[model samples]
Target: MSEKFQKCVEDFQCLNCGQEVSGNGFTDHCPNCLYSKHVDINPGDRANNCRGILKPINIAPKKSGYTIFYKCLSCDLEITNKTAEQDDITNFLITLKNQ
Candidate 1:
């Protein structure tokens, strides 16, 4: 789906694990499992409309970025997100070991 940038609201329930999630303006993953659903093509923009379960598959440390890989649980959509502090979760360390 095409993307149109817009502001995002918080307190969304994770479509993957059915867990309640909140975005303090920076969070993008479920706190329980570190998984995210493909809700937008651009960050904070509700454009993709896929509503697919985006699983954390791998992690890559960039020279000036933090990468998190995701594969959708429904349509196999893939998405990558840069790390953010408000995105703290227990599964982050485990994801880093993948790559």
Candidate 2:
């Protein structure tokens, strides 16, 4: 299998905040709430079947951008995602504070 994260662009409703999120081909987390689902083992592969809610727990600065850390509420799995350009500033700040 190819070890690359696929670019799957699909809109999904935020399970945590109940927001109708529009996918931009690279959107993984909800822009309004910054919450993501534990759907993929790798970036857009969607091979994993955990299907848990990934809650934003912390943020860390990286060379390219900020990395948002998440902890799965159901499975206790930890994951990280890069900060998107369209991410909300207020939510980003709130994540930083909670880190």
Candidate topping TM-score: 2
> Alpha-carbon error at 72 in model 1, in Å?
1.0
Pull out the clashing pairs in model 2.
Answer: none
Q: What are the lDDT scores of the predictions, listed in order?
A: 0.73, 0.82
Candidate 1 residue-wise lDDT, 8-95, digit = tens: 7678887656878867767777766678868877877767768777888877787754688888888887889876654554566765
C-alpha lDDT of residue 6 in model 2: 49
In order of appearance, the predictions have TM-scores of 0.68, 0.80
Pairs with backbone N, CA or C atoms under 3 Å apart (clashes), candidate 1: none
Task: Give me the displacement of residue 84 in model 2, in angstroms.
Answer: 0.9
RMSD versus native structure for model 2: 4.7
**Worst ten-residue run, lDDT, model 1?**
86-95
Q: Which stretches of candidate 1 lie over 4 Å from their true place?
A: 1-7, 15-19, 63-65, 88-99
Top-scoring candidate (lDDT):
2
Report residue 3 deviation for candidate 2 (angstroms). 22
Report the lDDT of model 2 for residue 58.
Answer: 78
